[model samples]
Target: MGQQTVNEPPVVEGPATQEFAPEVEKLINTVAKFTVLVSQKLPDDVAARLKELAEEETAPMAKMIYSTMARNQDLAWQLKRPSCQDTGLVQLFVRAGTDFPYLDRVDAAMKEAVARATKWSPLRLNTVETFDEYNTGTNTGSRSPWIYWQTIPDSDSLELDVYLAGGGCSLPGQGKTLMPGEGYEAAVKFVLDVMTSYGINACPPLLVGVGIGSSIDAAAYMSKAALMRPVGSHSANPKAAELETELKDAIDRIGLGPQGLGGQHSVMGVNIENSARHPSVLSVAVNTGCWSHRRGTIRIASDLSYELLTHKGVEL
Candidate 1:
């Protein structure tokens, strides 16, 4: 992130003024465009890491697969098209400041952004209402494009983490509540069990996010949140960070490799995110991000200036 910051315009508490409505709409349109762009373009950090992995791989078949992946990334950027057919289920985590002027308009702006991206990004129709079972085509049905929000104590900017959770990865998300006596050791066992059983079903070189919290839902949310972290980033807690390294090494030994064809490594990395847990309940959850890991961060200034934090050469 750049230290150079812009002073946002004055904040209007109650609602965005009529004069600002069009400006707000402009912000929505810009978000819509970037939403589409992100699906088409892999983030810079991920691309760089993949390249490094490719160069390090020793097996000829594995190296060739990695080269093909690089070509796919290049072609996607060149043609401005999605690299994967599963454009995925969109999940947005937003950190909005309390002092921000357009709080009331955020939901509408984001919803419009998703809708517009469906057409312009040509996102696959991944949403369908339960029971009724028909694609909305618009990608806006019953919280189809899920948005998780957090309001900051005192800030005016809006920060977002966008995730494309494809069916392969989403289908394998695992959660369990372990008894206190089961301990963190059991939690690690559960993750290992899940990966051994189903990790390869999702793409390999997976980014494994382990969540430990008081309840299953809390653990699950933290697990997904962990996927937002950069590939090589580890938890601040020394114990957690150490466990991340251990687990990554252990899992990569399974040799699922890139796209599960067999290679030197099974995972890109492991990340653990935790919260204060109940003495009686130790809930653990695991969320696996695909090898083509589609995740990005963006910041929107109060004055509507934008920054694509996870990608380069993006304009808004």
Candidate 2:
């Protein structure tokens, strides 16, 4: 009081802003942990199917190899290690609500989660720049965590589907734009032809995803989307759903079976994705999934709370 000294106010820090819901943050971490766990564990259904195929396989050598594979998968799961040497590329399909709280930072957070998962799960460094050939040992780089986005109306949460797509399985994606006059029959025939020719190499009991639309690129994208449908799920459109069933039947009749050793189940399922197209053009695309069929999905609320769709009972 006597000196009347002037003192400046002290700077105070506020609490950190939470861009995402606590539930969402928890879910993301859970997914990251499960991704590694799933890579190591072959689900019971998959194991049983493989066993049935091994027993039914006519090719003696193929059966023997398949038996060995089943044994290896069992060992890997028991040991908590990756089922296959190639952990594959991580791809995420995200359906987010417009009202999602952490909408802006969701993608960035996902990329960081992938990187962390790669280190914690010790995922294979699969991403490499096409021209530069730089391996991003962390399983992430520019666009390394591939994401497909959709805005869900009137919802408060987000849904995420993750796929660990192996190079062998993804190699079969193909599309062609045909003259409209070529007709839907022609498209169906083309799909069959592709399967008959290369389906064996793709590792059957395949999940067949077909896309039909205006342009080759659009169709190609739809085809990949079809792969996200659950096994035995059909398109919502009646005609499209019928096509899925028919195609599944036709493919199964091919007798390619599990591992292409030949059996009753050439494909486990088929799904079709379609779009309205220009009058003059008909585009068709096809993508295949191997028997391993490794994929996981999660849904989050606008408030950032989430649910894991693919692997039931899994919490984040």
lDDT for model 1, please: 0.85
Model 1 Cα lDDT, one tens digit per residue, 11-73 = 322112233378778877877788788888888877877877888899988998898888998
For model 2, the run of ten residues with the poorest summed lDDT: 9-18
Worst 10 residues of 1 by lDDT: 9-18
Q: TM-score of model 1 relative to the true fold?
A: 0.92
Each model's TM-score?
Answer: 0.92, 0.83
> Distance (Å) between predicted and true CA of 95, model 1?
0.3
Name model 2 segments beyond 4 Å from true. Answer: 1-28, 42-73, 302-305
Candidate 2 per-residue lDDT, tens place, 1-316, comes to 4775434323322112224466556655765776776676644445555677677667665676677777877787678677777788998888888877777877767776777678777788898766556675678766778999898887667787778888878877788988769899999998999899889887777888999999999999899998887776778899999998899889888888667776777876788999999999999999998877777666666654555566565443
Which portions of model 1 miss their true places by more than 4 Å?
A: 1-20
After superposition on all CA atoms, how large is the RMSD of candidate 1? 9.9
Cα deviation of 39 in candidate 2 (Å)?
A: 2.3
Q: CA shift at 105, candidate 1, in angstroms? A: 1.1
Q: Residue 266 in candidate 1 has what lDDT? A: 87
